[model samples]
Target: MSTTEQAVLFSCAQETQVGILSLPAEQAQVGVVIAVGGPQYRAGSHRQFVLLARRLATAGYAVLRFDYRGMGDSSGSARDFLDASPDIAAAINTLHEHAPEIRSTVIWGLCDAASAALLYLQDTKDTRVTGLCLLNPWVRSETSLARTQVKHYYIQRVMQRTFWTKLLSGQVAWGALKGLARNIRLSKAASPSRGAGDLPFQQRMANAWTDFDGRILLLLSGNDYTAKEFLEYADADTAWSKALKQARLERHDLANADHTFSNRLAQTTVENLTLDWLATTSNAIK
Candidate 1:
């Protein structure tokens, strides 16, 4: 069957409107909503997301690729990570309303967006989602630490510090050293911790997956930095890996693919594998 492609806008929430590219097939059994990665608004329009959406649509699945609020053509402010969950929920709701006949709804997310979708599923308990496709999800505990490293490496020298006792004691040199020490301590404190907020983003994501009744597909790349990060944070005995194995989720690791599947052959391989997986899983569910 031929695929019909269209550009449309749908409200993600009460006042938020998202830009979407829809691929409609003649006889689609499921609908997929894609969530692209990047915490910043500018990165949402990366070529990988668009290419994957079109490829899946052409392969007979109805696909909707949209920008999260505040990114691309979507309505919202920039730097709104906390709001990503609601944005995804809104997109899923919109898909269901737009394609009521499609019984299965699959959510495809990459990097941080994948984590956001998991959080949404956990909070809403929306059972309409029949499958989840994660592309190099970013679920690492050291995300905060990495951010701190960047700041320290690039901008630490420019910051100024105040010495509290220097004004009182008139010991200028000692006070200066004390001020420097205090600044160091403050920076250390501000650095991301390994607590709940510091927990690997993926482990937090596992909470939702543990309860999901649908199928899951994890696509990893041996050369991808995110995959390397996963190895660093994931324990050998962790529940996340165990659950994935037990669930029999299709796991594919492209030896040469980068995080974004920048290589043309790698990207094509991913496309083909994903389409095949969807076809097989869809048939089994039917």
Candidate 2:
């Protein structure tokens, strides 16, 4: 474990200040901007990210981990998840401003946050983003949802959607399973929204990644349900294979880890692997 600095507040978009843990070194050569998962924001919940940031900082890299807008101590609505791209972009801009000497900037994200980063980079034209470190990134398409857990969790999601849809439909009646079933059916039958969901971002990201002149390290956990889903999709999609082949992206699989690396040993392994990759890539570039 390395020395870690205390948390600080940084202003992002429109007077919204996010809670950030800044780990700085006297001769930092690079800076990493990290975003945690959606449901996680408490300092305790992000101990792994904090530990990694401190360790990386000790290794001559400045690291910034901030709570996304509307989560944790940040000033914003929870709905910010719907448009978190700006949050990431704002964090990147703030990092560069705070540390102008940082020659390289890498964005690291887990799960949905990783998906947000992909979309953010695609939409923002002048960002200084140099590379990406995605951990079990969410890249599921409509078809991919079919393979998802259709039990309690899915049923709950269906019920929530039903409640909202019925409220909007002016139907005052509500039956738990019945309403949920109706909503699921409606959702399945509804036409897909154009220019929305993960497709546009996936297409743009796949294209950008293929032509990107920078390096990308994709880390996947063998036991991660999301990773399994992605693998299924990848195995079925030739475009994904072609894109990865053309991009020359690097992939690493942690055979014994879960999506969050809940196990201490697994988390440590992930941290070490990430640090090693950073050091190797940094030296190679130099």
Candidate 3:
């Protein structure tokens, strides 16, 4: 199907925000809302979102990629990723209003934005969110970060012959090793508090994952440490493991891709995977 793309202006908490909406020629009941990560606008790094939106639209799905307040063309005081719920909600409302056929919505997000989407779902329990496509979800906490480093980085380094050669030959800097040790210790000691509100962001993410009943598609980049850390986090936390092990989750790893899947081959791989998943999911639900 042919696609039509248009610029959109919407209000969130009295602040005007900008978005680009891509509408399919053939009407569809499902729409995708792309919630971008911090330090990125809707266009995405390397115009990924623009390309993805067009591709999805051409495949008969409506897509909306928008700027959160304080990012891109949107207006508001600078806010962190955790504070983007209002902006996301506003974008969804705009997409639905413009295309009333969008009865089912899938939120597609990357990195921190993926985490933010989970947070929003936990808070609102919005039924419109029928699915989530999360790529390299950011579940960063000091403890999880530390554990990931120790297991993936440090352990790998310890086994490398080149690392030992440098260390024993005095070619490695002592200060660097000391800093690593200090960080490892600090991260190990920094566990999340047990209290509800005081809980760490990772716990909050896990809570959202548990509460959300929507279908989920998780894409992991093999070269991205952040994605690896999420896997490690699942192993470290019993709650995370319990929820994930028994959930209706679909996961895929693009071994050749980096964090953003910048290369042409990797980028195409992501797009195809996403389109295929959406097609299959839509069929299943219908």
Candidate 4:
């Protein structure tokens, strides 16, 4: 299907946010809102977001890729993903306003943006958002990072011949061994206290995941450390492990893909997975 693209300005508090709306010749009832990750804008790394939006639009879904507060062409003070719920809520409202025919929506996000999507749902409980496409969500913490490094990095390195060669030749530094030891201790440390104090963002995310009745598509990139960390965290945390097994959730892994799915083949695979998942969600909605 042929698609049309245009720039849109929307309100998020006192600031005006910018977005690119991609509409197919025949719009579908379920629209897509692309929640951009921080330290990056709507164009994404190597224009991946732009390509994804266009492909989704070409497949007859109305797509919107936008800059939240303080990112891209938008004007505002900078904030982290934990504080992005308001911005995402605004974007979803804007999408609905632009496409009145849209009855429900799906949030498509990557990295911290994916975390923001769950946060948005947690904060607003917006019923219009019927699905989520999350790619390598951000659940980073000291323990999770240490555990992931020990498992994915240190363990893998120990199995390599080059590591043994360097150790036998006395080329391996003492600091490297100390760092490994520190990581080991951190990896085995107890989970943070959840008594009375404010709950951690990871717990909040898990709560949202468990409470949400909408369909979810989780995509992980095998070559990315961030993706590995997310898997490690999910498997380690009891709440997160249970949430991952929810009936409405689906998961896919791209073995050769990087954090952003920068290459054409990887990008195409992502688009295909998204399209297929969206179709299922749309059918269920009907």
Please write out the lDDT profile of model 4 over residues 1-286, one tens digit for every residue: 8999999999899999999999989857899999888688889999998999999999889999999889989999878899999888888888888888998899999999999999888898999999999999998999999999999999889799998889878999767778999999999986665679888888888888888999999999999999999999888889999988888999999999999998999999999999999999988978
Which tens-of-lDDT digit does each residue in 1-286 have in candidate 1? 5667666677655556554545566667788888767754322334776777777877778777777777777776754443577777777777667667777888887777767778778778887888888877776544433433334432453343333355446745565555545544544443233365544445557768787778888888877667655543443325566666655578888888888788789878878887887887788778
Which regions of candidate 4 are displaced past 4 Å? 168-170
CA RMSD, predictions in order: 8.6, 7.8, 1.7, 1.2
lDDT of 3 by residue, 142-261 (tens): 777888888778877878899878988999877757867966895567456667566676777788888888788889999999898888878778778886775578888998799999
Better of 2 and 4 by TM-score: 4
RMSD of 1: 8.6
lDDT of 2: 0.68
Question: How does residue 133 of candidate 2 score in lDDT?
Answer: 84
Candidate 3, residue 105: lDDT: 93
Candidate closer to the true structure by lDDT (higher is better), 1 or 3: 3
**Order of candidate numbers by lDDT, starting with the best:** 4, 3, 2, 1
Residue 20 local lDDT, model 3: 98
Where is model 2 more than 4 Å wrong at Cα? Answer: 1-6, 42-46, 80-82, 148-199
Once model 4 is optimally superposed onto the true structure by TM-score, how far is the C-alpha of residue 63 displaced, in angstroms?
A: 0.9
Q: Return the clash pairs for model 1, or none.
A: 139-202
TM-score, candidate 4, is 0.97
After superposition of all CA atoms, the RMSD between model 4 and the true structure is 1.2
Candidate 2, residues 229-259, lDDT tens digits: the string is 6665555555556755654467889998888
Candidate 1 TM-score, C-alpha based: 0.75
